[model samples]
Target: MTRCRYCNRPLRSARSIALGYGPTCRARALAEARAKVIAQHKPTTIERAQELIEDGGIVPLRGNRVWRVVSTDGSTTHKTAGQVHAWTAGLRGRHTCYHRVAAQLVALAA
Candidate 1:
């Protein structure tokens, strides 16, 4: 039996176009997509942080420690390293290295 990607519910039919996602999952996905489109039109804190990181205004800290702050274009500072560390530590796979965290940060910033 194929399982839903978002909710892990069993697929009721093989002909279902939304193969792995259940009805609730499909609705949630649609809602999230719509919200993302709306969000793109407005500059939120996340968007600003992404711009700062992409513009090289933020640099990942050295060593295995997981906390760093970056200066924004207006001399404001944004901190994301601690959040990243906490997220990575909560993962079930192999322990995440500092390099992995750095890469993830860069990706998130982008």
Candidate 2:
């Protein structure tokens, strides 16, 4: 007898046997797989930070730990330190901005 991939329950139906998952487990696995795919395609904060770094938008301030980050639109700029905490709307809470992320990447490279 075949067993479910997720719950380890017996798979009696031909479809379940072919899929190796019971009906409930198959639905759960499919949902999980869809969520994973969506997460992979979504633009994350770290990816945005990396884009800022790659675009030469981050510059150190006066040999200090502070950095200047330009917006992608080139209409605004923000100053942040390597350890500064910023509020991100997308994150809905306090988080580090691209300036700080660029600084951390530079530090790691050095």
Candidate 3:
């Protein structure tokens, strides 16, 4: 017997058999679409960067790097920020930052 694509139950209705998903699944899909439409759009990390300054704070681009910032100065500049964060997280030391300005930025963000 042909099964419902959604619930995997044996399809009883002629329409449910033709279309892959059952009536319940179709309703669920519609509700999900509507919820997405109604939900507020959240900005990504990069996009939210601008708002950081508007609230009267030390902005990332303008603010100095944390005293604890990990060096990427000469050689490591080729690496991405994520790579730098990962590298710093691995090191065992005091004052070593997970990012160029992470220590300072965290204080600023909070």
On TM-score, the leading prediction is 2
Residue 100 in model 2: shift from native, Å?
2.0
Candidate 2 Cα outliers beyond 4 Å, as residue runs: 1-43, 85-93
lDDT by residue (1-110, candidate 3, tens digit) is 87876678888788878876588986675566544422432234223323332433222332343222224342332121211333545344343332423332343333
CA lDDT of each candidate? 0.49, 0.65, 0.42
Q: Can you list the residue pairs that collide in candidate 2? A: none
* Tens digits of lDDT, candidate 2, 4-30: 889988888998899788878877876
Which lDDT tens digits does candidate 1 get at residues 21-60? 7767876765775455435443354465456545665455
- Model 1 TM: 0.33
Least well predicted 10-residue stretch by lDDT in candidate 3: 74-83
* C-alpha TM-scores of all predictions: 0.33, 0.47, 0.29
CA lDDT of 59 in candidate 3?
26
After superposing candidate 1, which stretches have Cα over 4 Å from the reference? 43-110
Q: Candidate 1: which pairs clash?
A: 4-20
Sorted by lDDT (best first), the order is 2, 1, 3
